[model samples]
Target: MRSNVLGSAADFRRGGHSSRRPLDSHLAQLFMRDLRADAPPQLPIFRSRLQGELLARLLLGPDREHTMLDLAVMLRTDLGSVVREVDRLARAGLLTLRRTAAGRLASRDTATPLHEPLAQLVMHTFGPKAVVAEEFGALPGAAEIHLFGAWAERYSGVAGEPPGDVEVLVVGAVDPGAAFDAAQESAARLGLPVHPVVRTVGEWRDDTDPFLRQIRACSLVRAR
Candidate 1:
């Protein structure tokens, strides 16, 4: 049933056009068809780290509304950079900006055809580390946090897709149960699996096992 609708939409894309049906409608249908079949389309690679980070926070983070000034401070980037990135994302149909009494506000464009799927992918790829840093930093016993595996490699600019699960290492005397509970909460919120390996500072420093050695040698994103 869905395929027939998609076939008609594809035909429209090829040539057919009507005054009653607008271009955006056809495009939305086409995008919906694609979403029905596979993962979301890939977003363009961002040249600026701050730009990427900003988008991830807007779409994947818990909050929906942010003023440009607030975003600049939160991302620790300059106001100019934040404005530029917001403009770029707006042009790309990935974000929506509106003028509010407080300031220029930005939020994800859920109305866009590809919004939900693209958001899921972005959150799965970049959201874990952000969530880990935000959620665990305040834990009483946590001393340090690290992200390893494919996500870490990609974050270090090695190039990789979002992995099935995020790998996290916590160095502290934190209760394993508490840490795992935190992981579970983060996972539920981020729409991705979170695998946390909790170890004492001494255990992490020992690095005796081959896996530990490899993880220690590779690029790691320190969450704390």
Candidate 2:
């Protein structure tokens, strides 16, 4: 089903874009089809990271109808802690809170129509090179996916624009060839770029100057 849709979309992209971004219009729509079903994937579950994630979510817009106490329960934290954070977040201008009918402290949805800004941000901040490298770090043994090259930058966004682009580096033992061809076909259709780096465990360990490092200049050092 997906393949057919993608193929049709690609057929429509004869020359609508510069480079390979023509598929973006359709693909972006497809990817966004169910994005808001549950926005939890965007949050950090770690106790320490929760505050920042919540704050980011507010900046990105979470339901403002709910109060901070409701949010505290959702966050599984004490109401007092949520209140403190709410105070801090409000001061930062990322969120606004109000008392709900249930007497809970809820956050105001200050988030703009975010998908566009977020997509652009993903691209602008990561750049094709660093985005790919970081992707490999998460995927492990991801060197083969590099074949996508410039297309990777297409999805990941140009080094600093952060809009209309998203870079993803998939490592692990996934088949690089299959992934590349799939991405190529998809890129031709949806126009999103996915730069992958797939390698064997041996390849990653065999050389100190890993392929990922070849693009080292592009990335911020991964947090240990």
**Top lDDT: which candidate number?**
1
> lDDT for each of the candidates?
0.70, 0.43
lDDT (tens digit, per residue) of candidate 2 on 108-159: 4436454355433423332333333433434333444342333343443444
Each candidate's TM vs. the true structure?
Answer: 0.48, 0.31
The prediction achieving the highest TM-score against the true structure is: 1
Tens digits of lDDT, candidate 1, 10-43: 8766867664556576656544443344322233
The parts of candidate 2 lying over 4 Å away from their true place are 1-51, 61-79, 91-93, 108-138, 143-224
Residue-pair clash count for candidate 2: 24
